[model samples]
Target: MRGPSAWSVADRELMAAFVSKVNGSAFCIGAHSATAERAYQDGAKVRAVLTDLDSAPVAEGLRATLRMLGTLTGAGTVSADDMREVLSAGVTRDQIGDALAVCAAFDTTNRLADAFGFESPGPGGFEAGADHLLKRGYR
Candidate 1:
């Protein structure tokens, strides 16, 4: 699994959480929720972003990046110009790549989990993974 880099771990978890929510994968959503909460001091911020990305209080660049990810998830295409626009917004290349990677990975994972009929184990399912992520620091 890809780990968070220079970007806030909270942001990475939020991305996973958002993708899981979009895919309606209860397992992933629960897991990511716990991971996010464990990784960030401001867990509520992650929840807020997961709840309504547009209204989430995050940096303008990150918000734009999330919007880009949403478009990619829905449309399956991101123009070169669109890439340039995001890059110009001060988003590093690695950050963009990592976000895209997380989005793509969750897309596949969500499908598999749902196709296999896996259900979320409720709120605490994230504990195991959260332990590892938390030990690694908040990023």
Candidate 2:
């Protein structure tokens, strides 16, 4: 999540949550989604993005980045046209790289969770974890 990219912390975290959801990691989805909600100030908004990307209430640039991230998560490759779309939508190369970094990191986290069979927390655990993360910082 460390980046000087134009994407906001909320947007980046939402992208991470989306990637986690795509990877079928409930724990990650919860953790990142709660953080995103804290930053964005709307849990429903994050959930909307999680459930559907096309109509999510986010900037076009962020939507484009999320699309590229989705492509990376699902297909393991980003097409030239996909890159073009994101770039054309005003997402900088740095932002794209940052998004890819989040995607890559979460992909590994998801696998590790599955490999070790990490148990997902209860309904309220995500919010608590988000609070802790915000207080302590990701570093």
Clashes of each: 0, 0
The C-alpha lDDT values of all candidates are 0.78, 0.86
lDDT per residue (tens digit) for residues 1-139 in model 2: 7447677788878887999988998888888999999988899899889889999888888889888888889989999999999999998888888888889988998889878987778768888888877667577
Estimate the TM-score for candidate 1: 0.82
Query: What lDDT is obtained when candidate 1 is compared to the true structure?
Result: 0.78
Task: Name model 2 segments beyond 4 Å from true.
Answer: none
Top-lDDT candidate index = 2
Error of 1 at 93 (Å): 1.6
TM-score of each: 0.82, 0.94
Which pairs in model 1 have colliding backbones? none
